[model samples]
Target chain A: MSLREACECISDGDVLAIGGLTIHRKPMSMLHELIRLGRRGLSLLVFGGGPDVDLLIASGMVGSLDAAYVGFEILGFAPNFRSAVERGEIKFTEHTEYSIMAGLQANLLNAEFIPSRLLLGTDVLKSLGYKTFKSPLTGEALVAYPRITPDVALLHVQRCDEYGNAKVDGVLAIDLLLAKSSRRVILTSEKIVSAGEVAGSPFEVNLPSTFVDMVVESPLGAHPTSCYPYYTYDLWHMISYLEYCRRGMVNDYLRKYVAGVESFESYLDLVGEDALSRIMI
Target chain B: MAPWTTDELMIVCMAREVENGDIMAQGLTTPMAIIAYYLAKATHAPEASIMQLAGNIMVYFDEPPQASILYNEYRAMEHAVHIFGQNEVYETIFKRADSIVEFFRPGQIDKFGNTNNSTVKAGRTVRLPGGFGIPDASPLYKKTLIYCPRHERRVFVERVDHVGGLGLNLGGATSGGREIRIISELGVFRVDGRSGGMRLMSLHPGVDVEDVLSNTGFELSIPENIPETPPPTSVDLRLIREKIDPLNIRRLEFLSGDDRLEALQKILDEELRIWRSSNVNRPKAQQML
Candidate 1:
C-alpha cells in the first residue's frame, strides 16, 4: 500500500503507538505524509520517544500522551512536549520504561494487569493512586500495571517483503511488541523485497506478515532519526530543528519540511544528497 | 605520571563498582557510565557483560565503538554478539536481578538516596525527558550505582521533588537488600542500609569532609576514618585516554554551559573526520540491509 493508504488506516482520536527507541528508526516519512494529510487529535503511546513525538505535539496533532520518556537524548528537553505538559495543553500520563513494557506484556497476555516490582515508594506511584496488591503465594509487594493496547502502531524498518515480513537491522526496541499488541500495524520500509527473499532468512524477520496490516516502501523513512546500517541520525538537521522549535516556529518547520513539500522525494531533495551521504553508514 | 582530572577519577571510581562477572546495564545519554563499562570490561571486570540501553536492543560488544551521538544503535550493530529485542533483554535482566549491577545518573538525589530524573520542579516549573528506565529497573538491580558528575548542593538535595527511584529503605523488599552507591566528583557516598541516609564511604584526594558537607543539601553520616578514593592506575589512564575514549566522550557529563556544547561539537567533528578517513565503504541504499 502507499503511504497515504497507510495513513488512511489511522483515524483521528486513535491511540497510536510510534515504534522505535528514543531517537532511532521512527517512521518519520509516514508521519510527514500524515501531517500533509492534516491528521489531528492523536493519543500517543510510546515507551521511548524523541523528535517524532515532539514533532507530533508541535504540529498540534497530539491530544494526549502516555509515555516513558520523550526528550532528545543529550540536546536537552523536548521543547513542545515540555510546554504542552506544563501548560496542560495536552493530557500527559507518565510511565517508566519498565511499566510501559509491563503494560504491553499484560495486553499481550490477555490479562487485566501485570504485577511489577517497580514504581513503589516513588512519586509516580503516589500520583497514580497507589494501585498495589500482594502476591498470594510469596506475599511480595507488586504494582498492578494495566494493559495499554494501542489502536494503531506505525514502525520503520530496514527492509520488508511484499508479504509484510520486516527485517529491522538494529535494536528491536519495542517495535515487535508494538506490532503484535496494536490492533493495526503499519510499516514503512526502506525497501520491499520478494517473499522468497524473506523466506530465505526467516529468522531475520522481526515482524511476521500476519501481524502487519499495511506495508509501504518508503526509503529513508526514518530520516533525521536513524535507520541503522543505512545512515546515522542527521545531527545538524536535528540541531536546526531544535532551533526552530525553541524559537516557536513549529508551524514554519511543518510547512517547510512536511506540509509545504509535495512528496517525500521533495523532502529528501531539501535534505540534500551530500548531507544524506555524510550520514549514510 | 600525567595528572588525572575529576572526570577521570569519577570514571575510575565508577569502574570499580563493576564486579568481575556481573552483568551491568545502562540507558541512553550516559557516556560516563558507558566508558566505565568499557574500562571495566577491558580491565578488572573482563567477564562483565555490559548491556547498553538496559536491554533495549543492543548487547555485549568486545570493543568500544567511537562515541558519536550518531553511533548509538548504528554502531551497536558493528559488534553486538547477540541482538535481542527489548522484551528478551528485560526478561533476562529481571531473571538475573539478583546478580546484575546497573548504573544510573539521576538529575537530583536526596540524603535518603531517593533520586529524581523525571523532573526538577521549582515553583510551577517542571522538567521533561522523564525517567526512561530509572524508576522501573534501578530498584530491581542487585547493585544500583549512581554517578553524579557535579557534587553541588543542587544535585545532592534534602529531598528530591519526585522519587523517580526509591531510597534505601523505602523500596521495601525489591530495593532493600540491594547495595546503592553514589560516585560524585567529591567522593563516594553510600546509602546506609540501617540509617536509610547517605554516609560518606570515601573522599576523593584533595576533597575534605567539610567540602562534601558544604556541597551536600543534607547532613551526612561520616565515619571516624574516611579513606580517600583510589586514583586511576597508570594502565587505567592509558586505556581511557589512548584506547577506549580517545575522543574524550566521558568529559561530556563533567562540562557545563557553553563548554559542553563546544566539547560535543569538537568530538563530532573528530568522529566525522575519522569516519571520512577510514577505509570502510559506505553502504549504498540498496546494499545497506
Candidate 2:
C-alpha cells in the first residue's frame, strides 16, 4: 500500500507515539506522509529523542508532548524543540524514559496507576501534578505514574509478514511494548516477508499479527536513524540536520526535506545514493 | 610518546573513579564515560559490569563497541545472558542494583550538582531535551558523575534554568551517601559531601587556578592546596588504545570532524554487516553456545 494509506491510520489531534530510541528504527516514511498531509494539533508520545520529534515540531504538528526526552541524543539539541521551548510555543508533560515506560505499562495492564521510585527527589511530580501511593503492607511511599494510551503507534521494524507479524532483529527495545499498549499500531518494514518465513523462526517473531493493524513496506525506512542488522545511522546526515537545527533553519530544512519533497520516495531521491551506501559500508 | 588530549586525561580520571564490583550506567552521547566504564573493567575493577551501548544489562565485550551503548558489538556479547527490557533495566539500575554508579552529560549544570537537560535562559522557555531518565532513576545511584566537554560560565551556572535533577539537595538532604562528581577538560569538580556545594577538586595539568575560577559561573571552593588530576599510566594508555578501543572511536565523541566521522560511519556499517552474518538470533550450528 501507499504511504498515504498507511498514514490514514492516524487522525489529527490524536496522541501518536512514534517508536525508536533516539536514532533507531523510527517510521520516517509514515512521518513524512503525515507531514505532507499537514496533520496538525498532535500530542506526541515518545521515550528518547531523535529527528522525528524535531520534524513534528518544525512542521507545527505537535501541540503538547507527553515526552521523556527529545534531543538528538549525542548529536545535540533538537532545533525545533529547543526553539519552541525557548519561545514558549509548546506545552510539555515532563517525564524520564522510566516514567514513560511505567505509564505505558499501566495502559497495557489496564491499571489506574503504577507505583515507582523514579520521581523521588525531583520536581517531575509537582510540576506534572501526579501523586504517589503508599504501600499498604510497608507504608513506603511510591510514585504513581498515570496510565497513557497513545491513540496510535507508529513503529518501523526490520521485517513484517503480510498479516503484520513483525520480526525485530537485535535489541527489542520498547517497540514490542509500544505496539501492545497502543490502541492501533502501524508498522513500516524494511522488508515484507511471508508469514511462513516469519513462522520458521517463531522465537524471533516479537509481535504476533494480532497486535499489528497495518503493515507497509518501507525499504531503508529508518534512514538517518539506524535499523539494526541493515545499516548504521547516517551520522553525516544527522550532523548536517543538527547543523541546520543549530542555526535555526527549521523552515529551510522542512522546505527541503519534509515539505519540499512531495513524498518519502522523492525525499529518498534527494537523500542521494551516496549517503545511504556510506552507512552500509 | 604522543601527548594525550584533554579527553584522554578525562577518560583516565573517570576510569580511576570506578571501583570493583560496581555496576555503572551511562546514557547516549556519553562515549567518554562508556569507555571509562570499560577501562575500569579492563583494569582494577574487573568485576564491574557495564550497561552495553544498546541498553543490554550486565553485558561485557572484549573490544570497544564500534559506537556507544546503542550499537555494542553483538558478537562480543558471548557473555550476554539475562536480557533486561527497558523497564527492567532502569528498574534494576534504580531500585535493585547494589554498588551502582551512573555517568551523565547534561546541556547545563549547576552549583548543587543539579544538571539540566530541560531548557535554557531561566524562564522554562528554552527547552533542551526533557530529562531522559535522569530524575527518576538518578536518586537510586550511589554516585553520579557528570561529563561536560566544555567548561565555562554558561555551562556551569548559579541556578539551572530548570532542575532536571536534585543533585545534592542544598537543604533537606537524604540519608544515602549520594556522591556527585564532574570531569571536564579543564578540571575535576566534586560535591562537598556535607554542604552539597561544588569544589574544585583538582585542576588538569597546565591549567591554572585563575583559569578555572574565571570560567565557572558561580563561586567555586578553592582549597589552600588543590592537587592535579593524575595522568593515565603508560600501561593504562596501552590498554585503552590497543585492547579496549583500538579504532580510537572514543575520540569521535568529542574531537570528531567531518573526515573522521565519515570514516567512523563506514566502519560502523561494516561492523553491522559482520554482526548480522554471525548474529545469535539466526539459526546456526548452535554448538558455540
Q: Individual DockQ of the candidates?
A: 0.66, 0.37
lDDT of 2: 0.74
- Chain B alone: TM-score in each candidate? 0.93, 0.82
lDDT (10s digit) by residue, model 1, range B1-289: 6899898899889988888988877787888887888888888888888677546544566665555565766565655777767778778877888767777888899987788987777777686688777877777776778989989998999989888877776654354466678999999988856766899999999997899999999989999999989889999898889887888888888786578778877877788888889887645434755
Fnat of each prediction, in sequence: 0.77, 0.53
Report the lDDT tens digits of candidate 1 across residue range A1-281: 88888898789999999998777889999888888877789999998889999988888899999888888787767888999988999998888777777888887899999887677778887766648998897998888888889999999998889978988767678889888888999989989998987777888786788989888999888988888788888877887898897687878988998989988989999989988887877
Could you estimate the TM-score for every candidate?
Answer: 0.96, 0.86
Residue-by-residue lDDT tens digits, candidate 2, A147-177: 8888899999887899999777545557777
For residue A51, model 2's alpha carbon misses the true position, in angstroms, by: 1.0
TM-score of 2: 0.86
Give the winner by lDDT: 1
